[model samples]
Target: MGPAAAAAAAARPQKASAAGGVPARWVCALCASCFVFGVFVINRIWSVPEPVKLNEKALFVERTQTRLSEVYIPCQRKQNSIHIGEILNHVSQTHDVIMTLDKTISNLEMRLAAARAARATKQEKSLISADSDIELSKVRPKVFFVMGIITAFSSRKRRDSIRETWMPHGENLRRLEKEKGIVVRFVIGHSGTRGSLLDHTVDAEDEQYSDFLRLDHVEGYHELSSKTLIYFSTAVAIWDADFYIKVDDDVHVNIGVLGSTLARHRSKPRIYTGCMKSGPVLAKQGVKYHEPEYWKFGEEGNKYFRHATGQLYAISKELATYLSVNRRLLGFMVHRSQCGAHR
Candidate 1:
């Protein structure tokens, strides 16, 4: 309308500029505020102590229909921040968000909770009351399978021979997937591309079964820390799949034994099974591959590493929850035994 008012209007962002139902003005304000507040919030967030929840013990039921372990959380962490606003967060590391919907929605929440309670009751009825002598296959749930794999690659994250980084491991993984039924998958590092990584030769960690896969290393983007990529990738498995496993290409997996072992387990422990070692959590932090305050060393007791073991252990769905919940504290331990200098 007026010249002064028109100029002011022109400075404002368009309505379409807003994304995720937020407007351009809000987006601009949020961005500006975050730039100002990032250090402060990051400091506060980093200062927050992470949890120390142990894994929930897994029990299996034998039945034709399967006592499926399906846990659907009705109250998901809300993506929106406060009462009226939200940020576009693609968190590789997710912090559980809480949403308090309106009165009507709150009622729905109660209903859902009630339903979950009823389901728990049904489960209680289905479980053993006092019978230790009973074999469960009759009333037990059917077997359910979840499949995933893990391997390290060169900077390319593609399979190829490098000076000595991950080529052999990559080849072994391909063979494991092709020859054995053990599943394998790729990981792209998060902080930067793997290709840019300097060619550093690391000794072959497992020399037992080296001929299995055609291992050429491809670098995936992600920082290498003791538990960094493993924690993040395992956290993803928390969202999908019933069972998960991570393996290095040099490892030999006896698929037949693996399948039988899983099939027979009445209760599966959250374990770092292949090779177990323990130590305190490290306090050191990385700059480009930064470690958060939460990644501090653990209590005085020994802690074990599941990494050095040849990459062929099985985990049930429930274990995924623990990894997600404890990521901040357990995400960055590097296995130095695998590290070596370029030849």
Candidate 2:
């Protein structure tokens, strides 16, 4: 081979990468080049003068100080322009350094004036206040309630001791009212609350039951409106509540704790109250919201689907409005029971 050809062949990358099959020599060359370039960049950065930004007012002060040795004050004339003959005579009498300094000072003044005109908007006080109140009082309240009989739908022939769950809810509301001084509103949509005193719909009273009332308002749970579509219809009801919470008629919530937490976070813009969600549920137990597009639904480890079931959920006033206004925009799901994804 010719000398140049032999040199090029020797410099060429020969060995393949162990994993991705890229040339190993090329990788080494690239890494070495990056390292050298990084060092050069860092050295150049270190050598650069740390820039100091000066306010116009500050620079004006320094310029005023430099004018101290000169005897005559710069006279302000009322006429349209300064007399050039007078300025030239003054410069002729002054030292070259003073003349040079005066010229530099004049140039700085002219340039600063033009710059001030160009950048007047940026220099003016901002109309938007950083001091705006993010307090709850800034927004009108929106309250949503998950009023209904929410219990485990068990087809087991005998009932579980689950009926005992009602005692705490009534007592809980009384405690919230008497001790905390917040009125608790409960709406019951199902026929037999069985244990709830605040049952909004009664089976014997209404005959068919007002099951559709609460279900019509929520998304995934809209199935009373059609369980097969199974969007948790509960979130729709949240739009109505300034600060809405949807707990199962079964779960024991410490409203004192909940109220305090809510009060502390009253100023927060968006809040979704719950324990962090995790894992998967193929079982019809616990909480379930079917998401066909799970990957786009959340990050790999983040288990929140498009919605959660009625076990428990809470929304702040702002989020209630967001949910209400955007309900039409949210494309919900449809299910085919013959080929059930859950089963």
Candidate 3:
């Protein structure tokens, strides 16, 4: 081969090698640039500043604590509110129970007070009745005036009140009977239920006091007129008196005034003396002064004939004897007659 051919070949190989090396260097430079960009991106992502990282951690902790506090505070407030509501409800219920108990206690106290008052009243009545009986035993058999106070089994308190106020008791009663020739007695009758507790109590009282004039008729509020008739008949049979007085147990009588008034009428033989009243005869039932057989009184609201008042009245011995003798016949007419005691 020629020198020129050999040189051309060497030049061609060298040009090829040089071209390949340039391409290799360009590839390595491109790979190095890509690696540097990846390293920069990793550093930017992982390698944060110390102060910035601490600030982020602190922010995260503060946000978590704030959230927890908000939740806990709301829950605690709700629990507190519920507890307060329950306490208020319990207090209200307790207050209502206390009020009810107080009312019950007040009622019991009132009842106890009433019972004590009643017991005291009964004891006072028993004492007065006992005193009256002692006085009655000293009275003489012969009396100028026989004052019969109408009474019943349940009228011990009324009798005691009269004895304490106007009627005399013990030594006073005995002195009055001895000085004035006037005898006072409580008039009563046996109970309808014979030998019952009521009758036994009355018997005990009578045995203790001996101031009661027991009647044959049964005791009843509806038979006042009949009781009055029986009283006159019985009084006449027992005592010899110038005047026989029928008085209600509830009446407050001035003994001095009564004695003086009776003395003025002592001369009259067939006298029936009392406070004269002309009240109307009540025919209606359930009335205060009701008359059962009011048809004979002329009309429903007709005024009765002027007569002695039934609460207190006096009859002469002759009239009392007449009433005693014809008591059975007078009993029928006593209620029908309008002239109350005079009839």
The candidate maximizing TM-score is 3
Candidate 1 displacement at residue 241 in angstroms: 3.6
Whichever of 1 and 2 has more lDDT, that candidate is 2
Once superposed on the true structure, which residue ranges of model 3 sit more than 4 Å away at CA? 1-141, 281-302, 331-343
Question: 177 in model 3: Cα distance from truth in Å?
Answer: 2.5
lDDT of 1 by residue, 1-343 (tens): 8999997787666543543277679889999999879989987876654321212212222332243322222222232233224333533223323223333454454345333333332333221233421223113222233333344534233223221343234567546445543443433222223334232222232233232221122334234343333432332322233345555444455556666777665243343334544334343455332223323334433343334343445555344434433333553334333320111
Clashing pairs in 3: none
Quick one: ranking by lDDT, best first?
3, 2, 1
Estimate, for each residue in 85-193, the C-alpha lDDT of model 3 and write its tens digit: 9999999999999878866764564345333333332333222354443343234167789999999888889988987788776667778778888888899877887
- Tens digits of lDDT, candidate 2, 35-154: 999999998887664332346667888888868624234443322136766787778878777757765764554345323322331232322122321222233133323223343233
Question: What's the distance in Å from true for residue 116, model 3?
Answer: 52
Reference-based lDDT, each prediction: 0.39, 0.42, 0.74
Off by over 4 Å in 1: 1-149, 152-183, 190-222, 225-240, 266-272, 279-310, 329-331, 334-343
Please rank every candidate by TM-score, starting with the best.
3, 2, 1
TM-score for candidate 2, please give it: 0.34
The 10 consecutive residues of candidate 2 with the worst lDDT sum are 334-343
